[model samples]
Target: MADILSILLSDSFWAAALRIATPLIFGVLGALLCERSGVLNLGIEGIFVAGAMTGWLAVWMGAPLWLGVLAAALAGAGFGLIHAILTVPLGLSQHVSGLGVTMLATSVAYFTYRTALPDVTSPPRITPFQPLDIPLLSDLPFVGPVLFQQTALTWLALGCVFLVWYVLNRMSLGVALRAVGDNPDAVDAQGLSVYGLRIGAVMAGSALMALGGAFLTMSAFDAFFFGMVNGRGWICIALVIFASWRPGKALLGALLFGAFDAFQVRLQTEVGAMVPGQVFLMAPYILSIIALVVAARGADYPRALLTPWFKGQR
Candidate 1:
């Protein structure tokens, strides 16, 4: 009890929790946006891989960091566009389309990596983003260490949460997007293009998903590796439901999972021999599943989700 309490109360724990949640924040927000617009992007896993690879590769090949980020976003958007075209206008199975996209994107990224480095056994590393010194904030006690000692990418993820919330709640564009998701016929009746809104949302949402991958390579670590995404994309899909499609709640869910993961790491260090290491690894996921089941009970999902919306169809 004392050891666990000490870990929970430590500033470093919270800092690590936030850092671990950074990629999730971006991923959940992306999934939320896609679902809001009536699209389910199971391709998120592949997009994450592609983003991490492309972003890191760009930086390694002499492009600037931000440009590498752009390359990642663009790569994600391209894959997203493929999924959108297949499902939105074509009215295909959203599940099949999304899964296809995952395979396609993953294959492309892996192929590119192997093609680029035919003989290299080790993945190359790039210069990652350094933590910003937030002046006075960096010097504060617990609060400073917890909130201010993160890379710019972490802050960017936080900012994106606010931006997504605002756009979804406060803007007219958000209104249409939500409407399109709930009832595309209604949105189309109001002179809005249902196809356009859904496609655009998927593309934009996918861009955000890729950014999550970028964070892995550009902020969390300097090198990209196979399996580095480690199912974070799938977790995001569930977290969106756990969040009930709300940005603020989505952030909380991500953070909670982050804390669980961070705590498990500490717990492993404290009693690695007593318990199997795999149990510690599974703790956060098991806890998250419980939370998801509880929160998802009353989750009011988009009405038109998974329903094909063909423009002009009565």
Candidate 2:
């Protein structure tokens, strides 16, 4: 109990929580956009892996770090387009298409990584993004370091929460998006192209998802590795449900998950041999499952979710 309390009160623990949550926030916001448009993007996990690999590869190949990040976003957008084609125009099963995409993306990343660095004698590395301390904010007590001192991507992720909320609640595009998610046929009756809107949302959302993956290799760690994403994509799916599909709520959910993850890491170090490290590692996932169960009943899923839309078919 004393050890847990000490760790909880430490500034470093909270800081780590924000750091861990950054990618989850990006992923949840991305998933939120696609799901809100009546599309269940299962390709997110693949896009994430693809982004991490492509971003790291870009930096290794001598491109600027920002350019690498852009490359990752673009790669994610490309995959999103493929998913849009499969689920929207082709009228395929969203679940199958999404899973196929994940398999393809992850496989392609592994192949590319192996081909590029065939000799694993020395793994490639890059100068990852470093933390930047916000002047006045970082100087404050308690909240300063935890909230203010983080990488640029972390700040951008925080901004994205607000951006998604504003776009979903305050903008005309948001209204159109929500309408399409609830009733695409009605949206079509109003002369808007449901396909176009969905495609746009998927691509845009995927770009953000890839950016999250890029953060893993470019900011979170200096090198890319197999299984680096480690099910964060799946966690985002549960988070979207837990948040009731709202961006603000998603932020809180991400933080909550992140807190569990951070605490578990601390717990493992404090308990040492008393508790197995795997148990601590499993805490976040177990909590996620429980959260999903609790939140599932009240989740207001999009009305048109997982439904294939054909213009003239009733």
Candidate 3:
């Protein structure tokens, strides 16, 4: 018990929590954007895998690290367009379209990976981005090590939380977006294009989602492997609900989940003999389930979330 308490109080645990939460922040922000605009994108999982593959491949092929990130974002945007086509103009079920997107993206990534490197016994790896310690901030006691000692992408993820909130609450475009999600017919009546807004939102949101995946390969790990994402995308979905669709809350939620994951790792190492490994592994996911149940009450989802909008349909 004393050792566990000491571990929890140490700076290393908090730093690990931030590291674990970084990718999740990207994913949750992306999911939040899509859901806010009335699209529930289950395709996040596949997009994540695709981003990881594409970004790593770019870096492996001699492109700059930032370019690899761009490639991932673009690939994600392309997938989002496919989803928009299926769910927006074609008016297909969002649930079906999203799941289909996930399957299609993951399969394509797997096929490409196999075709590109069929005989390799060892996975190809690239030089991943190292942590860029902030100058003065990193010198601060406790806080600096925990927050400032992260990769560039992690810092960007933190900035995005504020950027998303600003755009959603203080921008005109955000108003139209929220309006479209709540009532597309009303938005259309006011001379705005519902299809355009939703498509834009989904594509933009998906690009961010892809960036999250790219972070996995380009920063979190130097190599891309099958199942590397390991359901972080799905966790982002739960996080959206747990956050009640708010960006600030999403950050807090992601941090909480990250803490659990970090603690689980510590537990595995420190108390492995007393507790089963599986319990530690499952701790984060179990907490997510509990969060979902707790946050569901009074949750205000977009009114037109699953409903396809038609020009004149009542």
Candidate 4:
């Protein structure tokens, strides 16, 4: 136990944990945005895989890494548009529509990555962006390297915490979004375009989710694999509930889950017999369950959640 604690103190542990948490952080933030706007995006997992496949395909095609990222974002936006068409325009169930999108994305990634390009592999799985070292801070004794030295996407994810906080808590657009989520009919009565705003929210949310996926394939893993997204998407869904739909709180949730996941790997490496590796791997889910219970005890979910908003109809 003492050795494990010591290992936890090392810069490598923190860096690895942060790297693992990056995608989840992005997905959680994206989920926060959509859920706060009264749109449920369950296709995060599928979108994530799609982004990975899309970005990887772009890189394999000799395009610049930034271009690959752009492709991933576009792919995500495309999925978001489909979500708006199904849920907002067609008045379909949010969960069903999101699930359908996820299924479609999974299929796209599969048939494309596995079926189409199995023979042509290139670039040797190296990510485009390199980790940046903050001049003074990165050289600090222990905490510096862990906190200051990270890939560009890690810094971007951290910045997004504050950015999302400002957007959701301090902006008029945010207030409007919250209003729509809480009471879509009331917002509609105010002469606001509910469908348009919700559509924007969905597209924005999907774009963020897609970026998270790209980060995994490009910066984190540097390659694409079938079902490579693991369950980060589902984990982000739980994070929204745990954070009570708040962006800042979602960061803390992402860290907690990230640490748990990190610890699980280390535990399995050191003491694989005492606790079944599977049980240790379940830590994130178990923590998510506990967090959900605590959060729901006093949660204030959007009033319009899962409720369809029809123009001029209460």
Candidate 5:
């Protein structure tokens, strides 16, 4: 057991853990934004898939990798607009609208990927985003690769965690957003634009979702595939509740889940003589369920979450 623990604590293990956690961090960030603003974005799966496909498509078009990344963010925002249209403007059920957006986005991603890039047998693999090797720190033994030599996106994700924490806690916009989530009517009574704040929150959430997808295609996998998101969206939803709408906690949760996933894959490979890989693969799902259960016990979810705020409703 000590030997096994040592292997798990190796630099390579930590590096792989960070790599897997990147997408979750992005998704959780987006989820944090949406849920804090009283919107439950069940469409995270769709947004992720759309971003992957679009980012891949852009790469196929011979565009710069950064352009492909930007395209993914734009794709997310577009889908977010659709979500806002149905749930925010039309007063549709937030749950149904979110699911609908997911379904529609999924179809769009599949058909477009197939029809437009028919010759592509698999998702076109591109260069993984470049890693930044810190001059002094990257040379340190054991922890360098894991902490210092990660792709630019990893650093960005970390920065985003802090940025979001600040924005949600200290900024004026954050206060207004919380006001809208807690009671839009009161926010309206103050003559603030509830609609505008909601729109901004949705767009912000969608952009983060897109970045998460970009991490999968442009950094982690270097390619996209059908249903590539594979229920990660649901995981993000659970993570948001588990983190209690806190950005720092969201980052921590993502890393913990990522470590679990990394270990599952490693265990399956190392102990194939004893256990089935599928069982290990299911570990992350089990963790998600456990988290949801714990969070549901005494969670402080947004008071107005999933409640449609019609302008005319007093």
Candidate 6:
């Protein structure tokens, strides 16, 4: 109990939790946006790999860091466009198209990495984002390290929470986006282009998803590794359902998972190998699953999610 209390009381633990939550914030927001517009982007997993590889590659090739983020976003948008075209206009199976995009993006990223660095045995590294050191705030007893000391990208992720929430809740575009997701026929009756709205949301949401991947390579670590993304993308998908499609709840869900993750890492060290390391590794995921099951019971999903609409269809 004492050890657990110490772990929770330490400022470093909370800081690490926030850091761990950053990528999920971006990812869940992206997934939320897509779902809000009646789209499910199962391609997020592959897009994450592509973003991590391409963003790191861009920096290694000497582009500015922010520019590398842009490169990643554009790459994600391109794949999203493919998914949008197939599902929206052609009215193909969204699930199949999304899964195809995932496989395609993952393969392309891996092939590009091998082709670009054929002779290298070890992945190269670049300078990563450093945490901010606010003079007064960073010196505060507890609050300093917990909030003011994150890297720029972490701040950006937090800012995006507010941005996404505001846009989804307080704007006309958000209203239309939400409406189209719930009842496309009604939106179409009002003369709005359902195809265009859905396509745009998927593209923009995908762009945000790529930024999460960029955060992995640029802020969390200096170099990219195969499988580094693991299953964060899928976790974000479940988080959207857990959040009931609300951005604020999405942030809370991500932070809760982050706290669980960070706690397990510390607990693993404290137990000193008495418990198998795998147990600690799986703890966060198991907890997240429990939370998802609980919250998903009452989740209000977008009605048109998975239903395809065609022009002039009655």
Measured against the true structure, the TM-scores of the candidates, in listed sequence, are 0.98, 0.97, 0.97, 0.93, 0.96, 0.98
Worst 10 residues of 4 by lDDT: 120-129
All candidates: CA RMSD in angstroms?
1.0, 1.2, 1.2, 2.0, 1.3, 1.0
- What ranges in model 6 sit over 4 Å off? none
Q: Model 6, poorest ten-residue lDDT window?
A: 280-289
lDDT per residue for candidate 3 within 148-177, as digits (tens), equals: 888898998999999999999999999998
Clashing pairs in 2: none
lDDT of each: 0.91, 0.91, 0.90, 0.84, 0.86, 0.90
| Residue 164 C-alpha lDDT in model 5 | 88
Better of 2 and 5 by TM-score: 2
Candidate 1 to native Cα RMSD, angstroms: 1.0
Local error of candidate 6 at residue 127 (angstroms)? 0.3
- In TM-score terms, candidate 3 sits at 0.97
TM-score of 6: 0.98
lDDT of 1 by residue, 66-165 (tens): 9999999999999999989999999899899888888888888889988988888787888999988799999999989999889988999999999999
> Cα deviation of 190 in candidate 5 (Å)?
1.6
Candidate 5 residue-wise lDDT, 1-314, digit = tens: 77579768789888988888888998999988988888888888899889888887898778888898899999999998889777776768889888988898889988998898779775667776887899999989978989899988898888889998899899988998888888989888989888888878988898889788888888888777887788998899999989998999999899988888887777777787797667886788899999999988889988988988988778
**Candidate 5 Cα errors over 4 Å, as ranges:** none
**Candidate 4, after superposition: displacement of residue 297 in Å?**
2.7
